[model samples]
Target chain A: MDEFSFINSIKQSTYKQSTLLKGVGDDAAVFRQSSKDIVTAVDTFVEGIHFSRKTMDPFHIGNRALAANISDMAAMGASPVFYLVSIVIPSHWTEDELSQIYRGMQSLAKQYKIDLIGGDTVSGNELTISITVIGYAACGKARYRSTAVEGDIVFVTGTLGDSIAGYHILMNPGQFINKNYYYRRHQMPDPRVAFALELEDLQRVALNDISDGIANEAAEIAEASGVSITINYQQIPTSDSFSQFTVNQQRNWPLFGGEDFELLGAVPKRDWPLVQQAAQRTQTMVTEIGYVDIGKELVYLQEENGRKPLNKKGYTHFKQVKL
Target chain B: MDEFSFINSIKQSTYKQSTLLKGVGDDAAVFRQSSKDIVTAVDTFVEGIHFSRKTMDPFHIGNRALAANISDMAAMGASPVFYLVSIVIPSHWTEDELSQIYRGMQSLAKQYKIDLIGGDTVSGNELTISITVIGYAACGKARYRSTAVEGDIVFVTGTLGDSIAGYHILMNPGQFINKNYYYRRHQMPDPRVAFALELEDLQRVALNDISDGIANEAAEIAEASGVSITINYQQIPTSDSFSQFTVNQQRNWPLFGGEDFELLGAVPKRDWPLVQQAAQRTQTMVTEIGYVDIGKELVYLQEENGRKPLNKKGYTHFKQVKL
Candidate 1:
């Protein structure tokens, strides 16, 4: 079938959200304005740079692309309403693979209760997927990195370092002893959208998703909010599978290895209980690993040995090898 | 170098839109909702497929990417508010070339008064640009392709076929005597956004931008609206430079040539005067080209010889060559 025929097939689905006045099949998708503020984020993933057949299948690639953007929305304490995907497909990709990629997104959309409003699908040399996710939050309640203040307790939902371990195991299958749990962390990440929506009940919070790991994300909050942060390395949570990794990896991965898709945020000491209740309501793991302090923009890691400044850095996925 | 700085570098933009609570530094861009309905469109342009360096410079490529999405907004009779550009850069591209591309989009953003929202910039094998433009229109007033009804007067804004002819001139320089006008049309297309905003006063109308040429766009309206459309070939507007081409080229270019960025729409017969007044006020060249009638979904083109059925098709820019 022709390209237009393929794109048109997606819009003819039975699902249509009530808020969307128009979806696909139009020059632009139209939606009625809601009462809440709007949150939008765009993320692009290229085959050679972001994913490869070794680490991810077609479905996994698509799922990861959407998950990355949804994680961004959740970082802002917003619930996704709609998403637009623009994909550049190579001629070598079979139609089944394309359908599988779309099916992967549809599956996540169903879970998030978000509609695929519109997108552009075209031909290209490499598989490139860019997704723009739009979400909504209570008025003036959307979380930001700059919202962190002195005396706020920093926290994270879910165990960290597992996804990075999973990624390594995927790249080198036989090296790791425990694989399935970490592999699932890499293959399927549950973005904390429901948890973020629940956080809207609180008075205030500052959030950043752990896509770039806590070192980078926490530094961002410190820099933006003009505050200092100190995290206790011993208090950082991790799964048993992650703990099985090398000591260096156990320490480094949680701080430097990204793509965990977990929520990293700072809340007032009083609101920590509310956040814990929110996590309980969403049935998500919650842990307090850090606290905000009054100082110049700096992030320090408090280890058993001593306190050390953590550099604002994350692992790069832009590999030199082409897939 | 710290690779995490990509997000910080793009955060350099100092956009001053009041509605924008947060711009680039955050994981998601947050904006206050207005009274109008929101219109959103996403378009992807890939090197070797949608365009090549032969027909466009880096700046022109950037400009065209934003123009295509803005044109989609214009077709919906919406005023652009903000845009997010996700670009995949190849390693071969220099930093200056990348800056030039962004400058291209910045030039147009200045004209359209739209802020650059958050987007992902990553490394890739191809230069793929995916832009999502968000706009707003009067409540329940955004025009649609399916809004056309029986006895509506069909029309188009601005000269047709210029951009495609310009595209040809860019591809085959020195082949055409009239080069600059067409080249400018291809390089710096002024999306009819301002003109579209002026048309909001009208009671009812249907619009589809002529990115895929009038024949394809008209057929889309006919099919979507479940009406028949007939256009007289002699009445279609073309510039003197366009007319200098071969008679066959002149006929085919206006009907089948795409990327003119003109709006082809239908309105009730009584609203023709109102449309003319709006065009006059906006100082945009608009002309009557066709009319809608009750029939099975079909489009007809009238010529000196006879009338012929117009197919729902447009030229594909997916050339089989890598840049």
Candidate 2:
């Protein structure tokens, strides 16, 4: 199909929100903000770097790409309203494959009520999908990563290591039992948008998405907030499938395995009760994994022996380099 | 360099606007809108497709990518405020080369007062830069392509064939005279933002960016507005370099060669004087190229002999296909 026809096909089934003043076919998408502030993020997923044809279906690739951007908005406690996708497809791909990608995106868009505003589609040698998510937050309500106080308690929503374990299962198919569960987690991550909004209502001090694993993201909160973070090894939440792994794998995966798309945040120590109560009300499985302290270390792993420096071994795009 | 460290390096030199509540190192960038509505657009430039390393410098590649998206915003008469860039770089590129790309983007961002907010960086086999621009437009003031009236006069800003001529110069170096002019025009076609705003102030009926050449964009205006358009071939603006070409080259290139980044709009015939006066005040050279009429033909071209159907042969991504 030509560019215009492809755009028309995508436009025919789009769910337009009332806030959208103009959508597809315009030079630009115009929308109104009902709130005081707008939160925006862009994420690009390359075929081989972020996913592969051998392991991931095109539908899951599209789903994960949008989910990653949505997760970023979720960390800000914003309600996602609109998204623009720029996709470069390989020439070899079929029209059905392209439609599957859009269908995957529509599924998530329907759940979040996001309008697919406008984008560009091009043919290239590699498949690359970039999504920009625009969301809204009320005045002074959006969470930040640099607001954690020294005495704040650090918490993470949902279990970590499942995505990484799922990835392992996907790559080494028959080597693991119950591969479906882990593989699903790797392919489809549920962004904690509603849970993060609940935390925002409860007035969390700092927030970030764990796209780069718990240890790296926790260190980011500490570094940005100018505080020290200490994560108790025993307190780290792991999935039931994750528990089937050996001790070393369990310890390393949850701490360093990335792409979890979960929310990691800090709340004042005094407000722990309220935070827990809100999580309980929302049915969000949040675990208190660490605390902030007045020190220089970005993150310290508290084990049975002693507190040691946490290894910054999570995924960074550039190999053998630390951010 | 790792993704985080590269982001930190970029964050250090970024120009943050006062309206930006949060920027790099956050889950999402937060900004405030002084206007009632927001305009957004996304465009991706892929290696070997939109540009090639053999013909264009990396800096020009970056600049052109951002300019393309900015032109979309200019078409809406929106003030470009912020942009998020998601870039996929090959492993072979050096830090200097990557920095040059960022520098190219910074030059345009500085000119437009757009803040570099937040985005993701990843590794890929090919270089792909996708930019999402967010701009503001006053409530009910943004122009739409679907609002042209039957008796509206169509105008285009600056010249149309310059970009395509420049592309030819770049691709076939020694074959063209005044190569610098054409090459620069191709690499950096100035988006008519200020001019479009002036036209918008003058209450222009409809507007669009001429990224896909005069014929296709004019057809878009016609189709979107449900009106017939007639073009006077003599009235179409051509750059000095473009005029130096043969009559056939001039005709075919301007009509069908894409990537002009000029503003195409419709104004009621009665408001022509106001539009001309506004354009003069803004020092923008705009030419009346056509008229919207009460018929079903999307576009008709007037030559010396008689009127003929204008072919929709502008650049579309897929080969040998029409929308």
Highest-scoring model, lDDT: 1
- Give the DockQ (2 decimals) of all models: 0.51, 0.55
lDDT of 1 by residue, B156-249 (tens): 9999989878877776666676688788898888888888888888888999998888998998899889999999888999987675787888
Q: For all candidates listed, what's the TM-score of chain B alone?
A: 0.93, 0.93
Stretches of candidate 1 off by over 4 Å are A175-178, A315-323, B1-13, B175-178, B315-323
In candidate 2, which residue ranges exceed 4 Å CA deviation?
A1-5, A12-16, A175-178, A315-323, B1-5, B12-16, B175-177, B315-323
* Candidate 2, A13-72: lDDT as tens digits: 545577788887778888887556899988888887778877679899888889998998
Candidate 2 chain A lowest-lDDT run of ten: A314-323
The superposed Cα distance between candidate 1 and the true structure at residue A300, in angstroms, equals 1.0
Could you give candidate 2's per-residue lDDT for residues B7-96 as a string of tens digits? 767773655577788877688889887556889988888887778777678788888888988998888888888888888878898877
**Residue A113, model 2: Cα distance from true site in angstroms:** 1.1
TM-score of each candidate structure, all chains considered together: 0.95, 0.95
Kindly provide the TM-score of model 2 when superposed on the true structure, using C-alpha atoms: 0.95
